[model samples]
Target: MDSATRVQESRVFPHPINVVWNHVRPADFKFWTSAVKETQVEGGLPGEVGSQRKVTFKDGTVQRYQIVELSDLAYFITYEMIESNPPIKSSAALHTIKLRKITHDNSTLVEWESDYSSSGNETASVVEDSRLKKKEALQDLAKALGSK
Candidate 1:
């Protein structure tokens, strides 16, 4: 039996729920994060469940992910990494993101979670590095959405 590693992070953005979840969920990741060099949706329509996207990072690492589940009403999406490289070359990975609107402040609370386990020796570090990237992405998205 194999155990999966989990990483979770939450950030509250100073934007409305619809703004964060629907209006600006990064149609182009390259516009939101400098870490991502490019992203191309290769299957189905972009943002549709079952759609697959190949993403190239600034470091030249590439990974492909498929949208497994998505719910606009619930404000959540689940995806899995079908292909990856290097530290995660041999790994099982799934990620889920949830959002909730704060009615009082008109803000959105984002919860991002990742479950994965790699066969490589750097399994632990790989997950940690992912956390760092996720954190940076949140900051970038905040900036893009007009937050200081």
Candidate 2:
């Protein structure tokens, strides 16, 4: 098996940890995440482990994801892709998000990372595309959090 491609991005929000946590909920996906046209929970309850969601992008591609890990007290969550429209050929793809409070200013640092693999010959482009998309999504998140 080939090693998965990985991308990580982080942003510091001036808002406190609790505020950032509220905005990061799965229920609020479409509100702050760019490129998400629609999102609906397909199984279980939102924000809980084992919960699944189908997300449709503006381009009409769809992806089904399940929350594999969550810890409200730790301010962390992880999700794995279960299905995708274009069909990701990889064995697995996981997205993890973590939040930490910057004690001095009482602000929060948000870190998001994705580990994924592409099928066949699309690995390079797929990795690059995912990185750019993640960057855009983070920018949108920062804007929604009122961070400059």
Candidate 3:
């Protein structure tokens, strides 16, 4: 693993904070991102912290993730990528999605961020791929949130 590669994107949704929050919660992630082929419950409550999900991506890579933190008050959820079958290049990866209220029109600002480490010659390709996927995911979210 090398120094973490960070990817972040923000969007504003013309919906209530809780609405955007619920839509992007751990369990409902599949609803917004086409990169995920399927997701299965692995442990605990589907959307609660400590819960786990086995996610199969469209690229055919399978990975397991654990919900490490969830805060409705602060409107953020953090999860760690715990395992991968083909093994991720990153020794460690953490993803966080945060939301903030826009007081004026009751819209919501959602920020999706991911930090991961990759090594060797594949780092540039991997980072660029991750950035593209994140951008696509955010674009997909805008459609799912009905803001597109």
Candidate 4:
């Protein structure tokens, strides 16, 4: 038996948590160009739990994801691969984004986590890869929001 990989990362932004969550959740796939192609939501809205959405990769591979958990401004979202293939037989991926409001016109921190341990492929480095890519995304989000 092999253990799966768990990857997590967080960043502090100079903006409110709600602002960070807005870009990361509502425009999920559009959050980063390198990680996703376009997200096609089939169920409820972004903040609602139990909602289903299809995340299409730049390579055209699609992953059906469901919203398993949610909160007012702090929440966790999970994406389980309903369909499987060769490298990834099946996987349970979760992304948790927590927002902390610092002040009325000050900064906030955005904590992010992504776990892909249920994939069952210990040798695969997809989780690690995603972590690196996510760091860049955080920077992008910061830049994108700071200008607005």
Instruction: Name the candidate that leads on lDDT.
Output: 2
Candidate 1 per-residue lDDT, tens place, 29-90, comes to 65447688888988888778899888888898888888888888889888888987644633
List the lowest-lDDT window of 10 residues for candidate 2: 25-34
Instruction: Please list all clashing residue pairs in model 3, or write none if there are none.
Output: none
For model 4, the superposed segments whose C-alpha errors exceed 4 Å read 73-90, 103-105, 118-124
- Candidate 4, residues 23-126, lDDT tens digits: the string is 76653557666667787777887656777777777766677767777666343444544543234532556666666777766677677776665535543567
Q: Clashing residue pairs, candidate 1?
A: none
lDDT (CA) for every model shown? 0.78, 0.82, 0.82, 0.64
Q: Could you tell me every candidate's TM-score relative to the true structure?
A: 0.89, 0.90, 0.89, 0.76
lDDT tens string, model 2, 1-148? 4666888889888999999888786643664456889888978988878999898988888999999998888998899989999876566789988999999999999898889876666667767777888778878888887777
The most accurate candidate by TM-score is 2
Report lDDT (Cα) of residue 99, candidate 4: 68
Residue 113, model 2, lDDT: 89
**lDDT of each residue in 25-71, candidate 3, tens digit only:** 76546654678888888889887889998989888988898999989
TM-score of 3: 0.89
